[model samples]
Target chain A: MDRRTPVDDRTGRRIVPETARRADRPPTRYGSRPTMKDVAARAGVGLKTVSRVVNGEPGVTPDTERRVQEAIEALGFRRNDSARVLRKGRTASIGLILEDLADPFYGPLSRAVEEVARAHGALLINGSSAEDPEREQELALALCARRVDGLVVIPAGDDHRYLEPEIKAGVATVFVDRPAGHIDADVVLSDNFGGARDGVAHLIAHGHRRIGFIGDMPRIHTAAERLRGYRAAMEDAGIPVEDSWMSLGATDPERVRRAAEAMLSGPAPVTAVFSANNRVTVTVIRVLAEQPRRIALVGFDDIELADLLQPGVTVVAQDAAALGRTAAERLFRRLDGALVAPERIELPTRLITRGSGELPPAG
Target chain B: MDRRTPVDDRTGRRIVPETARRADRPPTRYGSRPTMKDVAARAGVGLKTVSRVVNGEPGVTPDTERRVQEAIEALGFRRNDSARVLRKGRTASIGLILEDLADPFYGPLSRAVEEVARAHGALLINGSSAEDPEREQELALALCARRVDGLVVIPAGDDHRYLEPEIKAGVATVFVDRPAGHIDADVVLSDNFGGARDGVAHLIAHGHRRIGFIGDMPRIHTAAERLRGYRAAMEDAGIPVEDSWMSLGATDPERVRRAAEAMLSGPAPVTAVFSANNRVTVTVIRVLAEQPRRIALVGFDDIELADLLQPGVTVVAQDAAALGRTAAERLFRRLDGALVAPERIELPTRLITRGSGELPPAG
Candidate 1:
């Protein structure tokens, strides 16, 4: 006789425990829990038949499958697949190493990655590197030790040679936003250089030769690319770039505010300014709103209320969600047997002209 | 002979593959990869000694440990803990199931949970339920199969008895932002009732008796609480709410705009509005900005660029990050051997009175 009591759905109550009700209940050697072996024995079937039924393989006869299914239901058994996964040497999951999750830029990126993972029937394991190289390496190594199928990294550091062995050990990796240093790998990047150049060129075309630039730390790849674009635009137009007109350091609001004020109040005050990245753009807009100058400004990266601001701000807009989606799609394709060599994909950015970028230089 | 290669700091190169001589080399099998056993054999030490060195566990003689460590470094051996974790029945990771990850509210909440998890030396595995109950159950069950140490769920489903077995097996679980149905579990909730009541009372004090309530789906727990608070405030003011003054459904922008227009245009237009959530508040603000009537509004949650708009948005603000942090801390505490029954934690929400909430009814 079967020892399990079936549960009724209507009343939402569990039947009494069989062992608790009777002191003479037989002591099961494998404890109170039921296993597949017990289900097979109860169904009077071979162990392989039960396994085939559980895995939904095609070899089982219909009558035998029904009996195994009934036994499984009666025994309340669930397959323990962790052991099987360990033997197969693959976990249908990938790691996403990104910057701060709370930042608006990364939020959409994470969502995009999650959608791709879901569609591919893979789970995502993610961690924020917090822009720290040591933390990034630690998180990456930990994910590798868990035997994830692949990795999608928005690198916080320039160097990632620590991943060489793991990559050579058959873990596919793709870098996003920036290239890995001292390594050759697939990369997806936004056209930061072209976007910045066009934004600066737009400011210059609006009759502003003296354009100040406020950006992130110089060590950052994107920041350096944007700075180079600014210099190239000024040189192409034969406009002398001043030392005081450039601020390449931290992205804090106070620092950005100081940079904007210094350029606006210098001996040869700039008639326009170009802000790099969203955080710097927001701070620069606030500073410009406070100043008396009718400065023409163009920022790289769009913000939420840029359209609603007084004299709406113009910007060079990069589709952050698209960047993430494209990167994630490439990652899954690689996992799906596309063993092609490493490729670099770049998505173009658009220049959105509102009022600020079109402002005429004050005499 | 030792095959170890020193790490190159300048170029960040570690070891060059033997495939450098050939343009293309096929990946090796899993067994061909170096293991702890191989390292121990190469170093002339026992497997346990190698494990001690790899796990940084103590109780090894200094010279012997150094030899094992050097062997590990030389062999490019990374410890595989999959088998060990399977035997131990814990992944040292927690699963965070949330609604929409891209939503500004949930982004900070996720980051807070991650911070708490990191502090406890645990990794986080997260997925978006996309506000679908089936998806929620699927994601939750998948996490359970992975044997996560605990779960932090922002529930999308009204029923969650599917998690009973996992909980019975001693997995710690905590629900945040909403309560799980048909289950007894720890929960963390914001003061939705109190916040909505205070916001409505503030509008009433401003001489706006005909208040409109725009809420989320009526079935949601927090939405119901906020709606109840609106009714309580109306009763306290001795004002009978008309049927047209309440809009309860999805918080989509088009739906909310139509609802806001219906309340403002028809006979007996409301003088003030109480938005139940952030998405509703945003849509309502856009509609109100278009109308000439001076309608007062107090939204349930704070949003970015609120202060920058004309007549800065007033809000009944709940600290989403704090809610996530508190819940995650409690979960980790439970994992650390805290044997206590499930408890309910309520965090307070604050009201910020900007210009909108203070606007009197149009004469």
Candidate 2:
């Protein structure tokens, strides 16, 4: 019973059913393609000679290899990797599950992971969960069914108990930007709590007692941690927070714009603001630009053109590339046989104060 | 005789050698994993019963299924998809190769492609060529080796004759952003030439004759087309172009900064500038903001927070998401048996006038 055997010894049937057999496969997709047999026939050679040439296996003579290459070109024969993957028992690929691929924050992160995977001679399969728990589970399990050598997940779902079987069955797994819930796993995250506290404290030190906190929903772990840091900083300064000054919900432009405007229009408008993330910060910058008085601001994530703005946006910048690289490195380490217990690693954040966070409360 | 058979009839050996056999596999990576046979033995059931239970196949009694599930949990057995993919002809995955994954311009495009792939029940494997032609060819062929059902390529390479065999073997392919070279394939591109011409014409209409063009290397198709547009607009205005007014090379910040400064300085310098791409535009904005005298500017490709800038950036905007979606749709259509000859598609670009592109020439 070699692990590579496709058929069960007792049943004489494939371990998995052949529901998508070649005969049943859609003709438009797989049909009308040349096979190794066709190449061999065209070259007047054995199938082994064709396979050796195609795989670069090095047994065929130069003449035979040339003929096979010419035959392959003439008939357009491609070695079927599905069967090769089955024989090899390793796909040399990994899966990355993230929240959104379009977010600027994720661009560098995904690229970093890709670089690391490439270094390890593996390709990356990326899927977006769209922040849905059900979708997250489906994508994760689907990648598992693809038998990726490893997985790096930015957990959109809290309870990842569904991945227990996969992890236990030897798929290397690493969680990035968030921790896996209800499971012990390797995790790499930024100091979301500490970074938020520092950003809020920067505003506090700037002589602003009243500040608004705009962030994502509190149910999200990073959002919750950031909100807690804001509160902690406020408490440390002996400044009471008002319900009117706190707006936590979706980070969509319209919602953030309304929240910022509402906080600014009140009789006791906030003198400063602490934005939790890049998207929220961008919207907040727009709202503040239209204001007659200067409102101090600090954001959690670094944005593309933040430094070039009028009053350059101050931020608690997390190294997105570093987070991705670290998680991917850990994943490859696990695949290379690191048998350590699952542990959490948090990278520190840097606060860059250009002008906005240092602005004084307008009289 | 079956395509799914791992062994060769003539040689009595695996077509692809078992180079990475279980015994030769890294002990820490795959050796510790439990197997389906272990689960069967633990549950006192046959291997077929375990397979049925794992795959959710019917004909197993509820009591027996429960037993198999429990054994699966206890033994940490996960179904191997490599074997399954071998039995079925399709891997249900696609590949995307782009210049750089970290570029903001590509983020939305990749996301749009992913959404289409999701709708079609296919996963996307992404690789970054980092603007290298060799790497682009390598990544493309590797995806072919992995048997991706289709490919969406924003090619960094011009010579794509390497992909001819794969395409002929029935792997659907669609080129985006740039057209393929030396190969016939479906292509989706933006109207770079028309868009740049319109943008420059708008600048000329604003009463500026000495307009500078800062762009990427002319080797890139889009850059060359944009440069052609600039020339057309200058010719249309009957303004003799100055050789000193054009800078074409890498779009790095340092290079662009030097180019913009040189164009703005010296006797009888350009009164306005047309940036060829987003990266160049961003650098140009920074340069223009620092100038004591105002310099009207138009840039290609819109940037995030452009509207919020002091003098909002303006330019010809190509729909990146639409490019990706159209390319992906075309690839799937080819896979669905569209026997139409390879065609080229050019999507229209929009001219957005914010503020930077509408300024008067400074004295």
- Kindly report the docking quality category of candidate 2: acceptable
Calculate DockQ per candidate and list them.
0.26, 0.24
Residue-by-residue lDDT tens digits, candidate 2, B172-271: 9999998888777788888788789899999999989999999998889999999999999889889889899999999999999999999999989889
Residues A35-127 of candidate 2: C-alpha lDDT, one tens digit per residue: 899999999999888888987997778999999999998776667777887777677899999999999999999999999999989999999
Instruction: Tell me each candidate's i-RMS in Å.
Output: 12.3, 18.8
- Per residue, candidate 1 scores C-alpha lDDT tens digits across B159-272 of 988876667656789999998887777888887887898899899999999999999998899999999989888888999989999999999999999999999987679999
Positional deviation of B257 in candidate 1, in angstroms? 1.6
Off by over 4 Å in 1: A1-47, A70-76, B1-32
lDDT of 1 at B241: 88
TM-score for each predicted model, relative to the true structure: 0.89, 0.87
lDDT of 1 by residue, A73-175 (tens): 7665666556656888878888999988888888888899889889998899999999998999999999988888889999989898898788777777888
Which candidate number has the best DockQ?
1
Cα error of candidate 2 at position A78, Å: 4.4
